[model samples]
Target chain A: DAGITQSPRHKVTETGTPVTLRCHQTENHRYMYWYRQDPGHGLRLIHYSYGVKDTDKGEVSDGYSVSRSKTEDFLLTLESATSSQTSVYFCAVLRGAYGYTFGSGTRLTVV
Target chain B: TQLLEQSPQFLSIQEGENLTVYCNSSSVFSSLQWYRQEPGEGPVLLVTVVTGGEVKKLKRLTFQFGDARKDSSLHITAAQPGDTGLYLCAGDGNAGNMLTFGGGTRLMVKP
Candidate 1:
């Protein structure tokens, strides 16, 4: 709670609408990631930022994009929301030795 | 292709029973981590294994990393209702910033 915070804990939107989920971290970790959880697919990585303005795609990066203008903030944007994108989105910051700290997730529902 | 596959996607057991969750991968990792996530919240780190053939324990839960560093496992002894949740395994294959997660194993310990 003190280290990281995710905005818009729950949201409902229609298809084709654009949506953005924000993750603000207090600890200045250099790496941040966005992942979506589905029933059988597990947690699939969408995008990740290694540092300010440096982003890379993960296995499931087709419909998502990420931006990190500052070391403490990373945002995930869905250009066109779809029903398939309706799932829990999680933000994680990486520390040394591959240790990660996760923020409370945001549940997005796209109709 | 999914690198990590978790076994027993869902498990329902009684209190005091023991359960083991596996996270297997073909790629070797620099480190492995176990997390427990409750609904509506983020996954919390339980333990991390960095060395090959390493084992770490937290109370009734035990975590182990494969000798080749390509897999990991978590064993919960004397399960309780509080232990019920979605268990996740994550790792960094080559010492990078982000992690690859397993499909996740959901366990329910009945009272």
Candidate 2:
């Protein structure tokens, strides 16, 4: 499990509301990533953090923002939740040459 | 954007059948990874191939990276019901641990 955990495994929110999902890891991996998986689209990276306070956008970063204040915590926020933004969010920690260890995942639904 | 195209988006076979999933791309990658995801869980890294034309095996599963580093494949021998899940391939082409994922292949091994 790499000690990676995501909070609020399931959430339902109304459109236009703001939502934040949290990812925590005890392994202290320097690289953290947020990805959303949907039908026909596979997993698309939304954002990633290389180190504390050093975050960068990914291929599908629109409408999504991420912050990493500490090595153990990375948060993904939706400023205005939209129906299209509803999907399963996964947080991953890079395990160097071995690859990534992912959290169980957080499923979000917007109505 | 670098894209990985996976063939046979869906597959259903009886237990003990053999199957292979392909992931191809025109762009070269430094490394490729294979992952398997089951219902209600995040993707689990299966293997990572770094050198071109490298082959690796994990029990019933075999992974291969193309000679040009532009493609990869996963072959399963005697698939079982437990093997039924979504398989994803990702390529690492950039820095900061960014990976581009292919559309997943959903496999069902009926017992």
Candidate 3:
């Protein structure tokens, strides 16, 4: 639970549509990460932010983007959704004092 | 390329059975983490082992980091249906504070 919440627990849309998924945390952590979980591929990092205005691409950052303008919120955008982009997305924050805290998750289905 | 490798891409065991999931790698890490993720949910942090050869136990689940700091293993005793999930291992050893995750092992404990 870790004070983290992800918007739109589930979504289904057609291809080429614009979509945005948000992750908000009550805990002002320094680091936030976005990951996608899939069969066989496990979890692949999409984008992560170390601080406000500081973000970097991860192992699988091609079709997605993210922004962190404030300390407690992070937003992930799919500029043009595609079928391959269908997966479960998760946001996480590094608690510093303990293990990583994860959001519930957003299951997006692009058809 | 991927640094971490996990064995037994999928596993199924009856309740009360014992099982082990492993993560192996050639690159050494400062610490490694184990997580369990259920469908439509984010991966929950199960354990974190900092020092090499460290072993931590929580109830029936035991996690062990290799002495070389390049591998880890998770053992579940008397497995229960509640333990069924996708188990993942992540290695942390970079300044980015990012983790390299394994392909993951999906476990199904039948009651």
Could you give candidate 1's per-residue lDDT for residues B1-111 as a string of tens digits?
438889889999999999999999988888888988998888888888999999999999999999999989999999999999999998877544567889899999999
Q: By DockQ, is 1 or 3 better? A: 1
Alpha carbon lDDT of residue A79, candidate 2? 99
Error of 3 at B110 (Å): 2.2
Looking at model 3, the pairs that clash are none
Clashes (candidate 1)? 0
Q: Order candidates by DockQ, high to low.
A: 2, 1, 3
Candidate 1 lDDT tens digits, A1-111? 338899889999999999999999997889888988888877888888889999998888998888999999999999999999999998988876547888888999999
Candidate number that wins on DockQ, 1 or 2 = 2
Q: Count the backbone clashes (under 3 Å) in each candidate.
A: 0, 0, 0
State fnat for each of the candidate structures. 0.88, 0.91, 0.78
Model 3, position A39: C-alpha lDDT score: 77
Task: For candidate 3, write residues B1-111 as lDDT tens digits.
Answer: 548999889999999999999999999998899998877678889889999999999999999999999999999999999999999999887658888889999899999
The list of candidate 1 runs beyond 4 A from truth reads none
TM-score of each: 0.94, 0.98, 0.95
Comparison by TM-score, 1 against 3, better one: 3
CAPRI-wise, candidate 2 is high
Every model's DockQ, to 2 decimals?
Answer: 0.85, 0.92, 0.80
Model 2 DockQ reads: 0.92
Measured on C-alpha atoms, candidate 1 has an lDDT of 0.88
Which stretches in model 3 have alpha-carbon errors above 4 Å? none
Cα lDDT tens digits, model 3, A10-64, are 9998999989999999868999999998877777889999999899999999989
